[model samples]
Target: MTAPHDVPDLTGSGEYLVPDVLQPGLTLVLVGTAPSGISARARAYYANPENKFWRTLHAVGLTPRQLVPQEYATLPQYGLGLTDVAKRHSGVDAALPGEAWRPDELRRKVEHYRPRIVAFTSKRGASETLGVPTGKLPYGPQPQPLDWPAETELWVLPSTSPLGHNHFRLEPWQALGDRVRELRGAAEAGNPSPETPVL
Candidate 1:
């Protein structure tokens, strides 16, 4: 697979199932385990109709209006971004190869972009990225990993995938959205954003 000419190979591996929609100064970056088959085929994040990601973003006030998958590239204007752990693969979590979950590369991206908050859309992605067992990870804010930028925060949200319906919850996502809005409000007010909690 060849990297899209328009999207720089941020990681330099030269390919992505779905090009990352990311840039510096984003308020939030939604990290997923990988694109679903439908999304990879569409070359857009959360393209699957059954996925609740797009709706959830609007429901939580992260996006002013509901956006279809095709509008993913426009998220940065709303202070949001998107990427996945398994960039070279696309499928359900179980089918992904071990090598595809590149936590180090994700860490590198986070260190460089320094988004105010990084939220994993599923426990599995959070676990793989943080090296913590999924059973130990709670929803919502997470402890900042060592060596991460001081101004950056981390969060874990329930997966919006229909396959994860049994465990899906909106409260955590709502909390994150609320925090994102708070930060934006503070920045717009020319006030120092609230301190990131130690937890």
Candidate 2:
């Protein structure tokens, strides 16, 4: 969703964050907690130099080469998209106010786009949207929950933030790439609804 009408458009004024990269038939959509302060200023997702999101995506073969955050607009060319549960906010999770989160809006976007997969870039984001405790959510493909559309799969990936240093691992991301590849193959074979293996 674009910023509310009342809120000034940051992109056009060179002061707002980059608009979300989303559309139908996307192979994957990466949802983060919110844009970091650096990202907001730079108008890019995962813009912080310390954030490993872009590197991880390249390492996992999701991108042809490592992309700088500034190149986020090119994500859809690779069948990928970017968004967040908190659209109008930009900061660390702890600093965000209660109104920052809009899970219902996220659900609406996901359902409307019907991407093949919706992967949360952090457990905190997944938990907030799924209404489950972070401790209960595992890293990788989630079971087909009632709240999500059956055509769209859900995944919880480790956060690439510097703050998540203790929990950072590239294995789960590589696994996500594999799943996307599998899904793409299935779709090419006229089996777009192949059941995703729960992880």
The estimated TM-scores of all candidates read 0.92, 0.90
Candidate 2, residues 124-181, lDDT tens digits: the string is 9998898999999989999877967777889999999998978998988999999888
Most accurate candidate by lDDT: 1
Cα lDDT of model 2 overall? 0.85
**Tens digit of per-residue lDDT, candidate 1, span 38-131:** 9999989999999999999999999999999999989999999999988989999988889989887777788778899999999999999888
* lDDT per model vs. reference: 0.88, 0.85
RMSD (Cα, Å) for all candidates, in order, is: 4.0, 3.6
Output the TM-score of candidate 2: 0.90
Q: Clashing residue pairs in candidate 2, if any?
A: 10-16
Q: What is the Å distance of residue 9 in model 2 from its true position?
A: 11
